[model samples]
Target chain A: MSAAMTQASSQAMSHAATDKRCDVSVKDVEISFGRHVVLEKLSLDIAQSEFIVLLGPSGCGKSTLLNAISGLLDVNAGQIWIGGRNVTWEEPKDRGIAMVFQSYALYPRMSVRENMSFGLRVAGMPANEIQKRVADAATMLKITELLDRKPSQLSGGQRQRVAIGRALVRDAGVYLFDEPLSNLDAQLRAELRVEIKRLHQRLRATMIYVTHDQIEALTLADRIAVMKDRVIQQLDTPQKIYREPVNRFVASFVGSPAMNFMPGRVERGATGATFSLGDLSIPIQGYPFKSPGLTGAAVLGIRPEHVLSGAEAGPNAFNAQVEMAEPMGADTLVWCRTPSGASFSVRVDSGPSIAPGDTLPVSFPVGTLSLFEEGPDGRRL
Target chain B: MLAIRPRLASRLAAWVALSPALAVLVVVYIGCTTWTIWISMTASRMLPSSNFVGLRQYEALFANERWTVSVSNLVIFGTMFMIASLALGFLLAVAIDQRVRAENLLRSIFLYPFSMSFVVTGLVWQWVLNPTFGIERIGKNLGFADFKFDWIVRQDMVIYCLVFAAVWHAAGLVMAIMLAGLRGIDEDIWKAARVDGLPTWRVYVSIVVPMMGASFATASVLMATSVVRLYDLSVAMTNGGPGIASEVPAKFVMDHLFERQNIGLATAAATSMLITVAAVVGPFLYWQSRRRAAAGAH
Candidate 1:
């Protein structure tokens, strides 16, 4: 009897582990529209309750990947698994997934109640059950008061709330959002972004969100998959992606006022590897390198914030003439040209009074630098 | 004072710009309509006379069997033609919307009949539906000796033949309108509907059709106007044939005015049509304007 009990417990433990595993998996998905390939052998695995954001610029296959996962688009060749079931051949309705569109895509003629309950009604759920689900979702979204109004009558934020409610009522294993906040104003987008984050925390449902907005990705995602040219460039936590991007493209794409790229080369010597540009050679003693013996014609990347200002400058400090100063409320962005003729930008506190042609002493820290090989691939060195 | 002077001058210029349209509306539409109403109350037969007749012609019009049959035929034709055109047009639009190849060619082919005048459409259909030489002869040539497609001559079914011809000509216009509506819909809406698990038909009926209220209204209103003024098709196809089985109200008015030389009865019939149209359309126009005003206010 004890042995049987132990066997049952082992089986239960295995089931729990499976439950904690990836709830949605796309394996080698290839999608094409006629002669144009949107995604090539794209694969992604989303753990149970993990909020993953697919972040990229326009035409970068992020939304296409989301559509493929939701079964809204057919793959040329691949498999998709959701909740341990292969749903590659399934219709979108049968895939245990719900989606929110960038336009909200609410039925303009129907009341919010009808919009939220339409899927349930289509699935032939009972009337009372549909009512219960819609009510629960409406309450969760705080849109119960707007249930009687049509989509045209609601504000943009309210309509999106009802859209989220429509997806929530499905009780699906996965939720897909394709730029759901792109159509909103900045204030509403920020407000709803927080709401979506709160929603993920409460429900813990696996969600795959697509957006070109890096701020949205950084704020709302547990992990971000940065995509470019139909392939994921890097998939990691937002902090890791921000601090240690896999390539020059990912680094430039994620940060605002983007990371400055200076043409340079890496030279290895007795002291350490040094990044040299014109006459400026900065030692890379404390820099992290994904691979060793990094000596090449490379490009050095330094974010605007990483350029130290004021009295923090040490021995390696150099003076650069300011070409432009943009006051952005919280900080002033000072664009200057280095002695090596490289244009560099530094973000300083608003209290500093700086002007164009004013030379400021700034130091490049070794810790926060990103070095990439100068080639077509632009891989990190 | 300077701003007010310029505003007053612009207002005068606005009046000047609108004078031509106002003149046409008054002289052509309202003036002619008023004259017709006045002429309906007279006892004119060969020519309009000033002899006032108090609703006598209307009573005579209602008493005429041909007039009664014409009225009933219009109801049947209007209902059948409008419903069939809308249904067939919506279906065609949906079919073509399936990302079909050669879409421009198909759309042009479907819309070709609408480009033709109704008189030409009616004449072409008359030849194609001729029992002795058209489909009947073709069927017999194919060795089906007992085949009969003589609805064009049958009294009870001649109205249906007219309906078929009318639908053939008008369904294309309806299809074009519906296709425009379908195209105007956001592509993301379809994606959302699919993710919601709604069937294609349900999406059309519940979501898409309701969203296309303006398109349907435009198609139906155009169809309704044609139904009321259905003279040319009747004359060309059936010509009130099989002993007045396919006679329509407009044809009845035309025949009484010219061939029968009964101007009193014709004017009475025309006046009745005008009143009926006004009765139906007036309230609708008022409601539409009121709704627009409310919307604008909001």
Candidate 2:
């Protein structure tokens, strides 16, 4: 095995063995709307003070699961426990949680201070205590100067900060965020993304955020629950999720430019399994197989960055004609067709001046390739 | 150059399209208003005359007992109808917004009264409020001999009967406006309030109602205009009533101008009504515009 592959797997193994204290547990939850089942017997366990992001495409039931955890939705059959208490039927306020919404959801007529203090007042907290909590949250979110302004008077990012402040003032055990940064522009979104990470670090509170943005999931989550078709496909640390997705759906969903899949058949030899595509044979010597002696019709998945070029190639090298090269400031994406006529892309440093019609040698490391059974299920082999 | 010419041509076409409306405003609205003021200053009765009378007609108008009762009746009726309709409409809107089944049907039923003309509304209510044959008669027939619902006939309480009918006719329209406002609210606000542990009533009172200022303004302004022009209902229901107990300003003007043949007094009363409306509405409009400007500035 290559040294880099061994190091990556060892790191993922260490992340899995850190802690097991479950602060929030959703067990056998079933949710449906009329005739449509949103979540069917779904279960998840979130560690205390861990930022767990529910990542999926739209309509993948990630937000619905978050709502169920927040007690905003009632499950047909399941139990939700928070801090050792079963809160299956508890009111959202009594569930020891606070939430931020995609639209900010600030009271338009209320000042920022009032927005942050409203829940405390509703809970019958003393006025002075409410004032202190509001002050602390406002200062934490850096919205002290905006406390007197109505939400309509504040900029979009400022309004979102106030929304986060509203949740922070609740001082609850868990904080829920539902696509809170989706409404902002790219620059503001990146700025607030960093601030949310910083806030999570400072508060050390259990937070479950939902978004379709994989960048947000990768940067903000201690662990991500990647969902599709009303069930979580994989739940693991972000590195593990990216490096070793459990199924084809998760393999394609969590990466930029997506992992490329080449249809092939796994051939069993005396030494190891080799994947064959058209007329080209690629060795799969050190590939970790979930099942031993994995031999059958299979597909090989390679990330664009993993397709090394020039002298970085170690073995299994082949020549391909470049069809196009797109320079993207820091890097260039070269779209090429293999000698056997299979198309794929290679992400290389921008230092290379390679153009279309040029031939370049690229290597696909067997240690980094994701092999899946060629079928409707497409489970990783 | 081509783009500039097309833009100028569109601008000229827009002006040409708006000219008819401008001419109508100048001739029909401003011209009629000026002519009425001029007639109010002159001593004209049954025919237009050139003799100037000035404030003499105003003096006579203030001294008239029926006119005094009409003005006071308007004050009571307007205040009661506006407040009651707004409260009832807002309540109906809130109830309907609770994801009720058959919502479209209920909304249509509530707003059905607004579709009828005031004359029809007044006539229909006149039968329902006829003490001898309405609730009083029904109660007596049901074996209660002392049942009394004769507000339409009572001298001191006749105006309240008018208020009840006006509220019924107008509250439905208010409900439709309030419903639209309520629907425009983000669904997330309700979820936030729920998470805040706010009682449903408190949420409506503190958060939802304050957000519906525009809807309330629209409903109140419509009610105010109806109050100022409260002639057809009085005419159809009670015809200024027994002993003119249900008299209103518009009825007074109509009676003086056509029935009593007192054009001079009628024009004076019309001019007074116009001034009263302007006095109340002008400052309100100015305040609203200023508030809008302040919000825009931020």
Candidate 3:
């Protein structure tokens, strides 16, 4: 199923590559309320039919940026362009965009059909066209049976689907989603996340999504813009963002169970640079360094899956005393203390049956390690 | 058994807490209503007399032209007040919700009239509507010599003047209730409407107003009760002037009960009012409960 979906998405993406008119450009946008600054000098360019996710914590200005692009918010300074037309002064509807909000925002008194077709009706579209568009959107959302029902009669997932249907009926060049699935339960969130990915692949519309969920960002975005403190920390493909976060904030935020950090020092010696924690030293000869020959007061960061244990430890392995084990169905997350007294976790396959207090030989693969300068802003080394 | 004990103890506590309210409902409300209904069926002049006269007081009350006029005036006042107040109040709420400056001050200013008693409000409006010294004279002084603002004294238009004053006094309370409802609505809905290209008035009329069914119901109920009990406003403003043009049901019952020394007719009018109120409220309460049950079922 996954392979087929990816194949379909790739085909749709290539097909969508031809439509360059829908590209969106946000130029030097600054948004502020009174004395508090929410976003300043933010700029981004989205290609036609691209699925771009703005990933950030709450109050990080991700949703604010989305709102600015949608023309629902007025930027204090800057121009927003959709399809080469400056839409900064235009109303949201005239900007050729549709948005799905976190709260669903479905009109409670309107039926699913009415909710989806309201925009067309307001635009003075003919009755037959409105009916056809409503029908098409309802079918696309698989809510044809629920078209006559009110939003109050639907479940959270169903209401969100109706909201998406409302946006779909617009047939606008750009689509904006502001944490649309955050109100759903875990199971429903996962379900809708996959559905949204599929819908993006099928529609191939220029979609900008805002989410705090890294999993959603990773799974849905063609490119993820990780933001912090009203600034874009990193913007890259999901793989690149996961493998090469530009700074500590992006690095710590983009992964689940999070990357482990050890306060260590990179010393430049006659035998090349080596990272030393307490008495344990590891050569970082193969690691990619942004600034080579630089040393001292650095932090070594490694994901749980990057640490190998037992037979896979290879040569030059260190013994780690196991602290606890949490079995998560397919794998076990074992918390352990290194010989240097640094605490970290390892993701071992369920077959290993690791337990607390067990001493395991684990090796850090130097190629996958991320070394950062130790300070408040932990820029990559 | 332990669970039952705590449950019973909590139930007893609830009953104990409700005892005073229950006593008032029984002794003051139900007892007086029962005695009034009984007295309406008897030949009671100034005091209670057990000479049974079935439906005679009601016949007399219906035949009385003043009581008839009072009933019709109430219907007009009730209909006009309910619509005008709700419309004006809802508009005021929508206007205030536009992120305006001095919103709290504006809200308090709008709501100030409701804080005053109806008699005070009526007296204030009486001076304002008085032809010689009020708006008519002010208009004439302002150089419009043909201005004729005399609705308060004109017999055919006097009830409307009462309606105007009452709406002015009560629309603020309705505004407060409707404003609360407007605030309770999710802000995202407005954004969605804007994205849908809905005009502001269209959104209020089609979406926002429909969503505030509970607010409308609450405001209407309060206004309806005031309509049924409208006596002080008329007394203070016009005192059934211009040949009983502004007489209301409550004032009729009051005059018959004390000033006219006709307790039987007064009780009869009061009983008719009780029945009329029940007739309107019964179906409304039933429909509300039914809607609630239907909502819960889904």
- Sort every candidate by lDDT, greatest first: 3, 1, 2
What's the C-alpha lDDT at position A47 in model 3? 92
Q: Cα miss at A27, model 2 (Å)?
A: 0.9
- lDDT (Cα, tens digit) per residue for candidate 1, span A1-381: 334323433432223222333399999999999999888888888889899999998999998888888888889999999888998989998887889999999999999999998887877776766787778778878998999999999999999999999998776668899999999999999999999998887777788999999999999999999998898999999999998888989999998889988988888888888888889878888677877876778988889999987777688888888999999999999999988899989999989699998889888898888888785458777
lDDT of 2 by residue, A1-381 (tens): 234323433332213212223289999999999989999999999988899999999999999999898888999999999877899999998887889999999988888998998877877777866787778778878999999998988889999999999987766768899999999999999999999999887767788999999999999999999999998999999999988888888889988878888888888787677888888888888788988876878988889998988778766688889999989888998998888888999999999699899998898898778998786459888
Task: Kindly report which residue stretches of model 1 are placed more than 4 angstroms away from their true locations once superposed.
Answer: A1-22, A268-271, A375-377, B1-18, B141-145
Cα misplacement distance, residue B56 of candidate 3 (Å): 0.8
Candidate 3 residue-wise lDDT, A134-164, digit = tens: 7767777899999999898899999999999
- As for DockQ, the candidate ahead, 2 or 3, is 3
What's the DockQ for every one of the candidates?
Answer: 0.86, 0.78, 0.86
Q: lDDT at A213 for candidate 3?
A: 96
lDDT of 2 by residue, B1-298 (tens): 9879999999999999999999999999999888888888889999878799878889999999999999999999999999999999999998899999999999999999989998998899889889989888999999989998998889998898899998898888899999999999998998888888888898888799989988999898899899999999999988888798999999999988898888889989999999999999899889989988987886
Interface RMSD of 2: 0.8
Give lDDT: candidate 1, residue B59: 93
- Better by TM-score, candidate 2 or 1: 2
Q: How many angstroms is residue B243 displaced in model 1 relative to the true structure, after the best TM-score fit?
A: 1.9
Question: Considering summed lDDT, which 10 consecutive residues are worst modelled in model 2 chain A?
Answer: A12-21
Q: Which scores greater on lDDT, model 2 or model 3?
A: 3
RMSD of each: 4.5, 7.1, 4.5
